[model samples]
Target: MSAGEQHGGRVTIRQVAVHAGVSEAAVSYALNGRPGVSEQTRARVLAAARELGWAPNIAARSLGTARANAVGMVLVRPPRVMVVDSFFTQMLSGVEAELNRAEVALVLHLVDAFEQTIDVYRRWYAGRAVDGVILTDLRHDDPRPAALRDIGLPGALIGGGPDDFDLCGLSSVDADVAGTARGILGYLRALRHRDVARVAGPADLLHTAQRDAAYAAAADDLGDLRYRVVHTNYSAADGMRATRELLSTAGPPTALVFDNDVMAAAALRVAHEMGLAVPADFSVVAWDDSDLCQITVPEITAMVQTPALQAELTARALLRALAGGEPTHVVLPAGTLTARGSTRPPKRLG
Candidate 1:
């Protein structure tokens, strides 16, 4: 029988090497596009492999090398929510850029809940599907770090405390959410907004809780600041509904702050429908600076967190963890405050 027929129509690297009259190593180098093979030898190997219909065994190759050469990112949110958020998009862009330079691949897995994220990680680890994993949006007493530690898995965390948890020798990047809150509050105080309303994200979220605590602490010293906090689901519709409720109160706030730009834009629309001019009758500030900030009639003043920068930093951290480095914590500096048309001195209360 011919070599192809003998191998059940499958082409082996040995057959390709024999056909090209080259070593198996040379065939491998040529097929993998490595530099060791000469141009003529590479051409011959390619021609032989093509003729024999040789296909590389990915699983066998991975097992032999013991390297997946890919990083996995587990995001604790729905895919739709992740897709709509500019922060995630820019962060992913940064991650892709860094990984591209290293010739590594990024695998993003979006899960709706913490349990689901954990389940996916377990499967990936058991299957050896990734070289490393990345964790984001950490909560109080998070179970992920501990679970990874027990399994001796390599990982990196974003927005969580390193000292509190056993991170399985993984690296971490922390954003100072409390400090971010203080800065935003300071900005509003500078704008002379004593009566302010904050539309916040889910309280269970670590960042949201930190911001809430910071706002409370900061508002304490500002005598008569009269701050009100409203919890929402980080949606535009929720923001609109919260703003409407706040506006209907006996003494509505002269300024509003939203945890996300999506809700902030919704607040703008709500103000318009209520016949209140932006930065005139009321002012607004958004936490994340994104395209949504500029879409409104009056652009939103916001904290500009470079998602791409965050993503790149996170990627590097993951790579370091994969290289057998001890877990390290990196707290990036706070983002810049961009002043736009959405904020100003409050209107006089008659």
Candidate 2:
């Protein structure tokens, strides 16, 4: 037999299968570190391949060196909102800056439906269209993290919470969202605002949930604190609607904290039309400290969680995983409260 044939033709997958005492499919799964095969079987397959000096045939393997050298992201929002959202655009710029350094491309796909988002990931993985992926806007009981791991895909989840850790090949980076809410509430309370309101984003988001729970706890601590929360879809119109509802109430809030700068900006307009005086009749604080917070008549107080910096951190996490680093969870510093012109002590109403 020729040396190649004697050595099982330079170690085919079938030979590795026979040597590891596993099925060919298991060998394939094991070789790729897929979820189906047990760790023992995976190790055995790897050991057998190593002993036989069987290097991967990049031309034949799905996850070979001839990769796309790109990262994938699927955003679940309308195109107009994405275009207008300073946070998303700013975060994308940060993600791009980090990715550009390594000559890696960012392949962004926008999907409105949840099912479509999952399909995008599946397509990207099957086609080997990206070396890794970045996930954002994490929701409660999100399934994408696990789905990526099961398919042996590498990804970094941004804005995920504490419960998002420890998937097989998934990494995560998140700021302390709850702590941010606490700081906001604390600031409002210090202003002697007894009636405070929070205009929050979607209830299904994990980050929103964290903030919601923290808001509740802080309100509880401040005895005699009358608080209300209006959930919106992160739209300007929704912000206007929620703001109008609160202002029309018999006991309107003296201070308001909005989920994003867009909503906060919208609140300013609605407040003006309702004949409410800024920092006199009411106060406004936004979660994100975007440019929108500053350009208005009175600058908005904000919880300054730098979106660009956060996105850069998340991209670094994805790069680390792609370079063979073990998956890890990174916790970022909580956002800081920046006092501005839009908030003041509530006026005493007899």
Candidate 3:
């Protein structure tokens, strides 16, 4: 029987090599697009393989290539937050959708500390369990990017900005956080809210710093504005606490901005408990438009970040890095502010 009919049509590399009158190594180099084979030899081997219907063994190919066909993602977040937060769930969904198209697997690990997250990276590298990693929750002066470089592992950062592109020579995916912050300030100003308070996330987070700086700059540009920012852990309980303190202060802000939907929902409860009518006594704004934001008594006005699209872009950037491409910085369009029933001109600006 001809090489084409060998092993019931499951032609092997050896059969292709024999048919082309070349070494099996030459066939392999040619098939893998490596440099060992000359152009003429490569052409002949390719033709022979096609004629013989030779199909590569994926497992063998991966072993020879030292490729895991998988990527790792280590998140330094509380397990409780990850389970209850739709932001992370949507992010994972988007990342998985793109990776699925490339036939790649995702290894996800959630930890309470940054050190443990780094340890997971080291272990993953030693075991050759992943081709690269995806980083999230970028922090100020973060060390993980440098650590990945030291480990000789490729990675991409999510929530990066233009200024962060050169961080540890890694790829990055970002949104226009600064612009969004300024836009929110302007929108609130237009609603005649002169004194506003922002209940922000962790102060150490890079995005938080960016938003804080932007808010300060915008507030300065808009003269006669009074604003204060309270740092929290992006939790509902913290949100209620911060809101209660700000509302009970001697000179309370007429408007409150929360870093997340859960926090804004908590603020709504605090307002109710304090006998303050939303948008009449105070206004509420949230950063991410989640389901909770929509179902509140007075639907919350929010900044809309398309988490799915951002995560997909992040996955794509990491995949490109794995393919020997130069590190890329992808910045999606700035998030838009969606107004709902939760905001209006303050009765009397403080």
Write out the backbone clash pairs for model 1. none
* The 10-residue segment with the lowest total lDDT in model 3: 54-63
Tens-digit lDDT string for candidate 2 (1-350):
22245354456777777777888888776665446877798899898877765666631463334556789999886635634588877889989988886668899998887668778888998888888889887776778877887777789877776463444567777787767877888888888888899899989787788778778888988777888899988889889999999999998899988989989989989988998888898999999998788898799999889778778888988988888898877777889998999999989842
66-162 per-residue lDDT for model 3 (tens digits) = 6677889988766355334988889999899889877688998878888787789899999888989988887767788889999999998777843
- Full ranking by TM-score: 1, 3, 2
The Cα local distance difference test for each model comes to 0.78, 0.81, 0.84
- Evaluate model 3: give its TM-score: 0.82
> How does each model score on TM-score?
0.83, 0.79, 0.82
Predicted model with the maximum TM-score: 1
Compared with the true structure, the alpha-carbon lDDT of candidate 1 equals 0.78
Rate residue 181 of model 2 by lDDT: 77
lDDT of 3: 0.84
lDDT of 1 by residue, 122-206 (tens): 8888877777887777777778877877666688776665344555566777676666777887888888888999999877677
Clashing pairs in 3: none
